[model samples]
Target: MSHDDGYGNDSGRTGDGYSTLGGTRQTRTRLPDGEGGDGYGPRRPPRSSRSLVTVVGVIVLLLAAIAFANLGGGDGDKGGTSGGSGGSKAGAAPTAATGTKPVTGKNGEIAAGFSQDQQGAQSAAANYSVALGSAEMFDKTKRDEILGNVIAPSAVGGFRKTLDQAYSATLFKNLGLNEDGTTPTGFTFISRTTPIGTKVTKSSDEQATVEVWCTGLIGLAGEGSTKPVTDGWFTITMELQWINGDWKAVTHSQKDGPAPVGSDTRASSADEIAGAVNGFGGFTYAR
Candidate 1:
């Protein structure tokens, strides 16, 4: 994966990769010699369109897992539950749902008003990571709205300025989008973040810092797309401060992953990936 560090520096790692929120990679999927050319060239053979209904079914199940993963309880606990009917050991991180309810307020489309405790800080950090990693952040207007909502008031201006430059027309073209950040006529642009779990490394009545482990999917999911949907793991550290009854981010940064080995599951087609992204909805996370 390749990424720009938002400061004009570019870097990348080989093997399976995902782009950082503000950075992007340019890649292409090649077709057989006799088949059509890449999206950059001629038209390609049309793929069968998968049913959005089937995609929704798969999405529902995946979201069930996502909900459980975010509800992982206990301070600083990683992965799943410590121990339960799934036979995980006393301190083992197992993926099990304890039925913990999610947070219940919104500042516009983003979750807001997290608690002042460690759990609250963790939840806030996780949700903010999602907002920061979303495809909507590519749009200038939406980017400003997201930063204003999630960042600390004292620091929002700096974030806005830095990100405005980071998400430049050049970056947009690298990601296969128009200069203004709109998807081309027939492609589905995907940029989403799912938190695996969060750990609070430091805490206080007025401030806390949390690290959110995450897996993100990015690229253009559609027939003839140069960039196909790909996944990668990363961790984001957010320094949060308690201000005006909510947890607001003072600063955040991302690094490569504690990624697991790749699985043997078959890769889905472009239509399926597009259908799934369009059919599923994101969540409001909680600890």
Candidate 2:
């Protein structure tokens, strides 16, 4: 709100934002008249009618200030909605921390106790989640590459054997792909998981539980396809331990949801969703 400051106006400013002033503003202080104290002064005369206008002006200004304050505050209210069914993709990212640090001493403490270096441990965790939740995990050849690259040398044999049987022939065929895991005719199979956030659930010198909350796009998204794109959310918790100067995944598990209700708009064609996903990139999380 603009203020007269009893003379000149404030420059380079207008009503910038709203603030709630119901409790924030102070009532105008009138000059004290001749009273029990300060006895030498004569009685003051009645003030001018302009005082009424000034009082009204101050009230409007205070309300405007309140509105400005609310805008700066992060609230449950947002400008747009996704057809009022789910949150808009354009909604500003809601923050959990008001003034919190991304990393405190927990991760540092765990790393310090480990025989391995800290950089190696964090890098290992980041890359391991990428590999485990990638689209390439659907194909045996890519799966082998991922296991070789991300999993520890000692754990590779068991990891590959377990996952090899887990992603079976029938499962691949059901994913709108060829028996060898190629995209079928008139179909574009999509299986991508993007991490939204990561946290150290529990950390120690030898072991830690890093939980990765993720969102994934699954099913085929293409023309003439029976499998339409579907979105799901899950939190995958990986147990990590220090070995060979690096953190390696000991085991991990997933639990579904925090899912929003489906929307009422016309469902976009598989091609559209596929095109959007292909064009837009997933974010690299900070906290």
Of the candidates shown, which would achieve the greatest lDDT relative to the real structure? 1
Per-model TM-score, in order, reads: 0.70, 0.54
Error of 2 at 45 (Å): 76
lDDT of 2 by residue, 150-208 (tens): 44455455445534443444444444457766778766665556666555534434554
RMSD in angstroms between candidate 1 and the native structure over all alpha carbons: 13.1
lDDT scores in order: 0.55, 0.38
Candidate 2 deviant stretches above 4 angstroms:
1-127, 263-266, 282-287
Q: How many backbone clashes does candidate 1 have?
A: 1
lDDT of 1: 0.55
